[model samples]
Every structure is written in structure tokens, then in C-alpha cells.
Target: MQLPIKKTIDSVPGGMMIVPLTIGCLINTFAPDTAGFFGSFTGALFNGALPILAVFYVCMGSTISFKTLPRVAGKGGVLLGSKILMGILCGVVLGHFLGEVPITSGWFAGLSTLAVVAAINDTNGGLYMALMGQYGTADEAAAYSVMSLESGPFLTMVTLGAAGLSAFPWQTLVGAILPLAAGIVIGNLDHKMRDFLSRATPVMIPFFAFALGASLDLHQVWQAGLLGLALGLFVLVVSGIVMLVADKTTGGNGVAGLAAASTAGNAAAVPTLVASANHAYAAAAAPATVLVAASVIVTSILTPPLTAWWARRVGAKAQL
Candidate 1:
């Protein structure tokens, strides 16, 4: 008897990314040493999120045409700007009330401006692309080329610093977009190369999703507790609203904006990176990491369904 595995996975909204991710999380949380236990190729699959994502971005970039570059940049800028502005607003408000130190007591313990801004400032590029591919257009998906600038600790640092909290070097910013740039150059130069690379875009999703999930531990979500859940909800709701408005205003139906409201899986690393850069954040770093990780999982699970709903509400067609 054949199992209806693909059908089962596809039945869930964003299941293509979320189901594999959930599996990886379960494996990492329970075994914890599975990668080490199985070396070589097996291990690499468990730990190769960034490399796979780099290739995915290049493949995504190949689908964009030079003629649509302006529109892509325009849409991306609006979403990116809206996200950063929301982070800055939240950070400034929280910094005024909470200052640099995280709450150390009660139900809200470990909540900090650092955590909020970091979670809000960065969007999950992988999730956004996946949702856009399913529910949006090529220009919308290509919009990530500009938005990828938010990937690392750079935007988080900038947001926190604006709130009086912390450079990631200039090279860091360039390195983030290099893969997409390479793909753009190649694709523009050769249509055959563009078609070939574009085919790999969807295929790379599950691989990177599982790898990203392997980097997480569900225990961190538990350690973060209610406050972490609250943070995740806050990111989804607050950032989601602003981004939705931004997307619609920029000639979109709000799908891309809503799709972008989730936190990046790698965003959990920003807290420690920021703390290392400026000791002022050192005390809040550990707690912030936990909270951001929870945001990653929470947003990853929720953004897809919510984006799908919004897309349907606005009559956006699913390319898939």
C-alpha cells in the first residue's frame, strides 16, 4: 500500500515548509545528537540551512527580469521600511519604559526591548518566498532581493541603536545580497540559465526548512514561557498590520506584507551578536535569544495560514 505522504503534507497550509520543519524540531529536541551520530551527508542535511538558502535565493533571483527590477525594488522597499519602522517604534517605546534591562520577575520576566526589536526587524525570507510563490506573483517573490538586507544582526543592531540600546561591517550587508546578485547577472545574460535555475526554487524549500528547524529546540520555547508566546503574537499582529497597509498602498493586495511579518529562524542569534557588540545588552542577551527562538517557531507556524487567508480575502491568485 502506498502512503499518501505528499497529499497529507500539502493538505496543511504552508505544510510544505512547516511539516518538515516540525519534524526537524522534534528530532533535534529529542535526540539532540542525531547529526553527530550520523556523519557526512546525513549530518550536512541536518545542518546546512544557510548554504541551501543561499542557493535558493540565487534560484529565486534568476526568475526576475531587469525590466521588473524597479517595481521589485519599490515593493521591497515599502515592506522593508514598514518592518523597520515598526521595530523602531516598538523599541523606542519599550526602551523608554523598560530601559536596557529585561524584566526579571513575574509573568513577563525576560521581556526586553532588544528581544522585541530583533524579532520585529527581521523577516523570514524563506517563509515569505514560499508564501509568495504559492499566493503571489514573481515580482512579489523577487521583492525579497531587497528585503534580504534584513537577514543578519545589522538591522537589529540599527533598530536597537536607534532606541539607545548598540556596526555590523559594511561587508556584511554586501555579502547578504551577493548570491542574488550573482543569479541576476547570470539570468539576465542567458535565458536558458534563468529557466534552469528558476526550476530549483520550489525544490529547495523543504531542504532549507528542515535544516532551519534542526537549529531550534522546543525546550527554548518552553523556557521562554508565556512572555515568549506574547512576543511572537505581538510580532505577528503589530508588524502584520503595518506591513499589510504598506503592501496594499504599494499596489499589492497585502499578501506579501503579511507574509513578511514573521521572524527569521536565524534571528535568534541576533541577541548574542548584539550583546557581544555592546556590553549594555549583555544582561538581556540570553533571555532575548530564547524569546526570539520562540518567535521564529510561532511565526513560522502561523504566518503561512494567515497569509493564505489574507490572499484569499483580497482575491489574490495562488501561482501554485
Candidate 2:
């Protein structure tokens, strides 16, 4: 008999990433040396988050076409700029108060500028497209073509640097983007290559997510629960308002803007990646990862209804 394993996981918001991550966290917390006991490819899987993420970024880049850029530039650019600007604004303000370190006590323990920025900066591209397809114009859905630029940690790194919290080397920044840049070049040059590589994007999420989880303790994940929920609300309300204004100013109904407010599942990987680049963020990475993962689940659940409500409030017709 066939089991409902995949179906069960699919029932939860961001479960594909979150479930495996939780499993990894359980293994790491209880049996930390399991990798050594089961040395070889199994160990590699437990220790290979970064390399997997690098490949995942390339696959993500392959999905973004240079051709789509010009077509949806106006709507897409406005949404993209608004999202990034909001993330930077929050990062700068929090960095001013929190610096690069996370809170270590009380209800807000584990909160950090890094977590805030990472959660707020990335949009859930898959969710945006689905919502826009249902309640917005074709152009609105296409707008994610530009927003996809926020796929990895590059924007978070820049926002943190701008906040004066950490300074990444010029080479570090270049190294961060090189895989994505290479994917874009190859994708643009060959349609078949683009198709082939882009298909691997979803396939890589669980692998890297599991690896990322292996690095964290359940205690940190447990502590981040409330803060992550609060951060998700902040992303939806603050980023939603900014993106709404942006969409309206660009001759849209604000549905697209609201749709763009959710955090992507892949965004959970950003803190770990950022920490790897700048040790200053290392203290914040594990908690930040949990926080971002929480944001992913929180936003994924809330955004659909929020988008639908906004579409109705503004009299935007559902395309369905």
C-alpha cells in the first residue's frame, strides 16, 4: 500500500522545508555524532548545506529570463524596489539598536537585525505567482521575474553592510553572486539548459534545509517561535503596505503588492549563508534560521487570505 507521507508533509505550510529541517534538528540535538557513526555520503548530506545552496542558487537563477525583465520591468521593478527598501529600512533601524548580536534573554531573546532583514527581504515567489494568477493581471504575476533577484543572501548582506553592522569583502560579495550570475548567463544563452537546471530548484530545497537544520539546536528553534511569528506579521503588515502603495502608484490594484509580502521557504537558508560569509553574524545564524523558517510557514499560511481580502477590498476581479 502507498503511504501518505508526501501528502502529509504537503498539508502544512512550508512543510517540505520545515519537516526535514525539524528532523535534522532532532538528530543533531539528540544524536550529534550520528554523522560520524554513519560516515560517507550520509555524513556529507548532513554537512553540506552551503554547497547544496550554491547549486540551488544557480538553479533558481536559471528560472529568471532576461527577456521577461523588459516586459514586466515597470510593475516588477516597483515591487522589487519596495521589498528591498523595506527590508533595508528595518535592518538599518534594528542594527542601530541591536548591533550584529541577538538578544540573549527575556521574550525577545534570539531576535537580531540579521533575522529581521533576512525574513523581510525575500518574497515567496511561488506563492506570489499563484495568488496573482488567481486575483491579478498576468503582468502582476510576471512581476516576480524581477523580485526573484532576492533569491539568496546578497541583498541581506548589502542591507547589513549599509546598516554598518558588518562589512563583507568585495570578493566575498562577488563569490556570493557568481553562481547565480553564471546561471543567468547560461540560461539566457540556451533555453534547454535553462529548462534542465531550473527543474532542480525545488529538488534541492529539502537537501539544504536538512543540512541547515543539522547545525541548529532545538533549544534555539524553540526560543525563536514567538519572535518568528512576530517577524512574519511585521513582514506582512509593513512590507505589504509599502508594496501596496508601490503597486497602486504603478497603476495596479495592490493585490500584487500584498501577494509579494510573504517570505520564501528558501529564505530560511540565508542566515546560515550570511553567517558563513561574516563571522559577526555567526551568533545570530542558528536562531535566525529558525526565525526565518517560522516566517516562511507563518507567511505562507496568511498571505493567501490576505491577498484575497485585499483583492476584494480594492474590487480587483479574480481571474478564475
Candidate 3:
């Protein structure tokens, strides 16, 4: 039997979640103690739902072939580097600007730096590739390009973890490496295995996104005060600058900055770990977590067209 689709489904993936989450946060401002209501919901959903996302990532990896690795190397390097360095550079510029904004405390300043960084989520990266019609190529360029983003989140996690560690915490990285290695092994197996996992991943993606969105406190938007607004505007301006600079330099691989802008989010995994590592910033942890969530939801909506526009302007092969 065919099930009827609700009009609300459109709001689920589109702008509906953003409005509610913002509203949730604002509700928190009136009863400062109530901020935890939305925040805890977010924490439960993201923290609880993330392991499933990890499993999806592992299954997606199960499909990789070693032959594709080299292709990811030559041209892929330039493309991937453009995404990373451009992000870092933009981050640095914003960091410098915020250095003067006194809205954040010393600890918050640290977490915000982490927040601006981007990582390659398998779900978003896959969507980006398909949109750009980059699914199959000599380099498996899209997949490889994604791996570059994939690795950075962990790196960002570790770096943020360091705010209190005083030195690189090899132990945390070591802990994450085993599962990653295991995933790579499974990801490189028989094609059937990879294919099965790939199919399963898409079905699971939205549930997580929706659940994550439901957890956000929309009320925070109002309570976030002037500082959050200032920061959000900074992200918009810096992201635009990145697109302009990248177009000039990369011979134009298509304007990805706009796509990058809409989807600009920290690796969802970073905050809880960072908070655990540094006790002082536990308060900043909730806000950082919400900010990343909002960015992900907002940016996901913004990326498609913004990317297409940039793609046409630069005459790049992909919309990216």
C-alpha cells in the first residue's frame, strides 16, 4: 500500500527545523534554567543518534577500492586542499576579527575557534558529489575528495581537545583510530558489502537530521544575544570572501564556498569530547553544540543553489 506523504515532510528537511530550534533556544532565555530543556534534547539526540551515523559512515567505507586511492591523489589533492585551507584561512580571519569582539570569554573564544572549522560528513559529501554529477571518475574524485574532509573532523576534534591537554593527546586519537581502521577494512571488502551499506545509509540520514533538529532550542536565537548574531554574520561574510579568493586561485573548480557556507558546521563529534577534555568550557560546550547544529541545518538548505551558481560562474566541471 502506498502511504500518503505529509506536507510537513517538506518542512522537515527544509526550513522548518531551523525555525523551531531557534524558537527553542529563545524559550530558554526567559527561564535561563530552562535552556537545558532544549539543550538536553539536542544532547540526547545528537549524542545518542551519532553512533548510528558512525555505523553509516563505516558501511559507506566498506565500498572503497584501493585502485581509487591514487586517483584521489593528484588532482584530488588540489581540490581537497582548496576546501580545507580555504576553510582554515576563513576561520583565521574570523578568529582575528572576533579577537576584538568581547562577547565571548577566554574559554568561549577557544571553543568558537573550533566551531568555525569544517569536516567532511559522508552524508553531505555524497549528496554534494551526486548533485555535481561527480559520482564516477578516473580518480573517484568525489569519494577521495570527501575523505580529505572526513579526516579533518578528527583533527579538529583533537585540536579542540588540546585547549586543556597542553599537548597532543595521542591516547584519544589512538582510541578513535581502531574503529576507523576497522571501518576501512570493512569498507574495502566485497562490492556487495559496500553497496548494501551505501543503500542503507541514505535511509538513515534524515531520521538523524530531523531528530537533531528537534533537539535544538529555537529560543536561543533571541537569547543568544548580540554576540551570536555577530558571529553568524561573520560566518556569512568570511565564507563569501573564501569563494571569491578560491575562484581566483583554483582555476575555479566551481564555487563551493556558498555550499560550504550553508553547510558550515563543526564535526558533531567534537564538542562532547572537547568538553570532557576541558572542564572550564563546559558552559561554552552547549552553545557550541547548538551553533554547529544550526549551521548544519541552515547550510544544508543553502548549499544546493549557492553551489550551482558558483559552478556556472567559474565554469567548473562540478557544482560542488
Counted clashes in each candidate structure: 0, 0, 22
Which structure is stronger by lDDT: 2 or 3? 2
Tens-digit lDDT string for candidate 2 (164-231): 77899989898888899889988999999999999999899889989988998998888888888998
Clashing pairs in 1: none
lDDT per prediction?
A: 0.80, 0.90, 0.46
Alpha-carbon runs more than 4 Å astray in model 2: none
Candidate 3 lDDT over 1-320, as tens digits, reads 85534445444433333443344445444443542556676545433545654564565455556666664454444444555564455445545654212235542333355455532221245334544463123333343443433431454544433322223357756644444455557657666666667577545445444444344455433344444444444554555565445434544353443443434322443444445544544554555556555455544655666666666666656423
For model 1, what is the error of residue 128's alpha carbon versus the real structure, in angstroms, after optimal superposition? Answer: 1.0
Q: C-alpha displacement of 267 in model 2, angstroms? A: 0.6
Q: Cα deviation in Å at residue 9, candidate 3?
A: 3.7
Q: Compare the candidates by lDDT and give the number of the best one.
A: 2
Which residue pairs in model 2 clash with each other? none
Error of model 1, residue 21, in angstroms: 12
Top candidate, metric TM-score: 2
